[model samples]
Target: MINRFLQNGLQGKYAHYQTDMLFNGLNWEMAGERPEGSHHSVWELLFHMNYWQDFILAELQEENPESPKDPSDSWPGSPFPSSEKEYTEMVTQFLKGLGRATQQASKDSLEESLGGRKRTPADMLMVLINHNSYHAGQVVYARRLIGAWPPPDGDESDE
Candidate 1:
């Protein structure tokens, strides 16, 4: 059903790559590297993605989270993570948000309005999935540009 599809999309099933797997085998140094011609580094992308994910999740929970007044607020901080620990924390948080969103998908009526807002959980989830997917590709491209693609556990033939 629609919920199943949403869940699959959140997990990157039947898509370019599993959302979680996209970050695998990437080291802190690589995550912080901004290949020439790229505007955002891998770490920045993850951070940005997590920021919006949290925003949508709050809405889903009826927490009434405020969207940043400025668009760039969602993309705050340096383009690169400061250290291995910082990079690891961001990756962990990103995965956790994805998991939370997937769980939310199965528990809601996709068409029901959330917090009296016109948008439903389904709409928010779709936005999150599409947002993540768009950036997932960029992450891969950044990796390839930096000669870090096919993450240690991944195979070039698989893509």
Candidate 2:
């Protein structure tokens, strides 16, 4: 159940814009570039999205995770990455964290409270789905604004 849900929503065919696809072909420079209407760069959005999901996943696993000092601290700071490696590393970490959480779904207690919250693992997953989808949409929009849509070979900036 967990695998299927994640596949379809987080990293699967059901999602029109898969996370991998959304981040694909983007160098650190491209990710840090904000399109006209986007308030946050792609890196910022991805960091924010990943932070929440990882936080909930940690709680679900009974791990001690640090909450952000302020709500905004959860997002990456100003002055995004200057190197492609840093960008790729974050993306890789996010994908791994997501996979770990999904694998634990069937093995872990989905009905138990995590971090004193009344919400269950199922609830956390629901939050992740909604939150990820929303931010993923933003990423897509940013890509479109910069003419990076239809990823990989399509970089409209040069054309």
Candidate 3:
């Protein structure tokens, strides 16, 4: 059975909307052009999430997939997605793919060792979820710092 709390909290329309706002909100800016000394922007975060999901899903299935090569530890570069629509689509696709993987994953499959670390597929899945949420929190903070992020879209009435 799925974890009801996580499914309710993290795998529903609410989660999708929150992810959308973070990646493609009206206040969101381009992935390029950082403010001087800082690194990462809304664009980079989206790109990072998309890239890793592609990587992990392919690896989990033992399929050979070619992901863009980036040397930066932070995976920084001009955003892989050239436009907001593309970014939004990529996020949507990954969420769908993740849901499928979770539903189909057997306990044995989830618990299979990868890289000799005994990482269950569940471990990898949660990493993607947690990692994205972590960056989403950062995006929220960045928006707050600039006073650009408004009350989230679904809660517009509160604004």
Candidate 4:
């Protein structure tokens, strides 16, 4: 039951918009544009989310990945993709990471600790879900600010 709930949260099933829905139909140009007063562009926000997602996944897999010495290291690179292809690749990678996390959540013992760390898989998964959810809202706000909301497929109501 816990695993099921974790998996659902990883997919943003009930708490908010699905990751794929929020990201679909975005072009590089639109992604690169930062709405007024926004701290980051859509591409930047996605990149930031992907950064932590990868980190959490590594820890879940017991990779013992090193924490970035500087907070900014997690948000490295340009605020936007360099081209259409780059943007597409970012989106693909982000979604793939989400899929990986969802798979991890299906494990029988989400409470099992990894690498002698006090944190369990469930702990990491919750962090990932919460982090992604926070940034997901930012992505939506950025899209709306730039007039890119209601992606080509339509809004959550259509779901």
Error of 2 at 108 (Å): 6.6
Tens-digit per-residue lDDT, 4-77, candidate 3: 43343334334533554454443324434343434566557656666676676776666756755654644645
Q: Which residue ranges in model 4 land beyond 4 Å of their true spot?
A: 156-159
Return the TM-score for each candidate structure.
0.94, 0.82, 0.61, 0.94
| Separate clash counts for every candidate | 0, 0, 1, 0
Ranking by lDDT: 1, 4, 2, 3
What is the lDDT of every predicted structure here?
0.87, 0.73, 0.54, 0.86
- Kindly list the per-residue Cα lDDT of model 2 for residues 1-159, writing each as its tens digit: 654665466553465566556687777888888778789888898788778988877877778689888998888776376578888888887788767766655554666777687887777777777787788788888877877676785343211
- lDDT for model 4: 0.86
Error of 4 at 106 (Å): 0.7
What would you estimate as the lDDT of candidate 1? 0.87
- Residue 72 alpha-carbon offset, candidate 2, angstroms: 1.4
Q: How does model 4 score by TM-score?
A: 0.94
- The positional error of residue 62 in candidate 4, measured at the CA in angstroms, is 0.8
Choose the strongest candidate by lDDT.
1
Whole-model lDDT, model 2:
0.73
Tell me the tens digit of each residue's lDDT in model 1 across 87-147. 8998999989999999988974889987688998899999999999999988888888899
Which model, 1 or 2, shows the larger TM-score?
A: 1
Candidate 3, pairs of clashing residues: 110-121
